[model samples]
Target: MNNKIGDFKLYLSHELGLADNTVMAYLNDINHFYDFFNNKNMQVKSTDIVNYMNKLKSDGYSIETILRRLSGLSAYFDFLIKERLIDKNPISFISKPKGWDKLPKFLNFDEVDKILSIFNTNDPLEYRNKILIEFLYSTGCRVSEILNIKVSDVDSKRGFVRVVGKGNKQRIVPLYNKLVEILPSYYNIRHTYFVKGRDTGYLFLSRNGNKLSRVMCFNILRDACERAGIRKKVSPHTIRHSFATHLLTNGADLRTIQILLGHSNISTTEIYTHITDNKTREILTQFHPRFRNRGKS
Candidate 1:
């Protein structure tokens, strides 16, 4: 059954065009469910699936998380039924959990300054790394997108870089002039580190002459955040959050920012609006005469 399910996952990836990571996640989720049932020494009926989902909630998994796990289970059962491994899909009657309306967390422009300025640019490598950090926050790109950036993708004349996002979707993000000014320095360092026909296309490289791993990028970001004295738990994604929030606070429209961030859904981009709470308070303080003048008027 495990092997059969694994074959179905491969079909989902190759035939249905699901990304590798997504397919793996689905497989893991289903495998976990299977393990849970086996440990209980019982087969999962339709009501048992519901009871398990409820148990997930009792165990403090959020509705969104439960929905994702349930969705994976449904897909797996559907595959089993189609393959005649199961008499019927047990997960067919199960409903998804309701999601909560949660806002995003982001840093202010000053906080971004605090984060970026922590890096010491005494050496060429330091300079390159600092520029890489700035460029990631300035562009609001995923870490995957940041490492994939090439010198030719940057257009100084257009002030943007063509980014290929999730699902092979492409979009152009307006480049910050400050970031553009420092890009050449990184490029110079990259040229120095270049070996003949060895990953000349990648934007960032490691000390081992290999492309920067996501884990390495994340560690670098966490170290920078600690150096910056930022109390908020920060990661590479925090820089991205700050990027979008800062732009929204500066009056960029949601649609344009969404395009710049390469988000396929407006809902995914809406998180930035929540991070502008401080900006909202500042605006009210400046514009509201009652608040500004303290009842003098």
Candidate 2:
């Protein structure tokens, strides 16, 4: 089984082309389960996985963490089956733990507008900040993808920008006309103020003219959120969640969003549906016969 772990690592890293962080995370999850799996003499059953999941919950693992572990174990078992070691994927029919599909935290449209409104100053840096935030919401991209975007990656005339996502996978997401209209001013500012040496070619630049980093991205969003007076915690990913949720609210289909967001698995993208699920409850509760008389009294 340990040797199989090594093989799976290779499969994930080399064949799947997953990022190091993702590969490391999956390996960690598998190893964490291996300790208990050894007790079953490597002949693990679905009940064994259920018992393990219960143990995880009892030990206070968050729903998100437990779900990640289950996902990793499922993938590992799938790999084993592919190699003809396992007869079946034991956890295939297992239900996700309750609340595992809870809605992700995201800003409403008004909150996003408020955050964007913080860049009212004429300062070139402020323009850059506005562009960054808008770019994030417009693209629905990850921080890594945002940092990796180069000027060449954007094709304004075509109204699409190429983005590289997890596992170095490349996909094209549409660039809104609003973003296109405002890009030139930022480009001019970037060329004049930010650049001092050889250009890094990344679209978003720091004061040093290098590509905007993850920490820089975080600070930019945080500062904007503070200025906008949004009390809730926000990050680049919050903007991402906002992007997906807002799109869903506006009636974008999940498959289109999955492509735009560069999700390798549609299931990974389905988390955003929890918001629609809330809307679902609202509609159901509003019309249900059980609720019709309650407010009347």
lDDT (C-alpha, whole model) for all candidates: 0.77, 0.87
Write model 1 residue lDDT over 147-214, tens digit each, in one string.
Answer: 87777888877688888777667788887888777767677777776433565676777765667778
Q: How do the residues 1-297 of candidate 2 rate in per-residue lDDT, one tens digit apiece?
A: 667888999999999998877898899888888786564237778888899999999999889789889889899999999999889999997887778776678999899999998796489788888998888999999888888899999998888899988878789899889889878877888899888789888888889888888898899899999988999989998899999999987789999999999987999888888777877778778899886667675
Worst 10 residues of 1 by lDDT: 96-105
True-vs-predicted CA distance for residue 80, candidate 1, Å: 6.6
The C-alpha local distance difference test score for the whole of candidate 1 amounts to 0.77
Q: Residue 84 lDDT in model 1?
A: 78
Clash pairs (backbone) in predicted model 1: none
lDDT of 2: 0.87
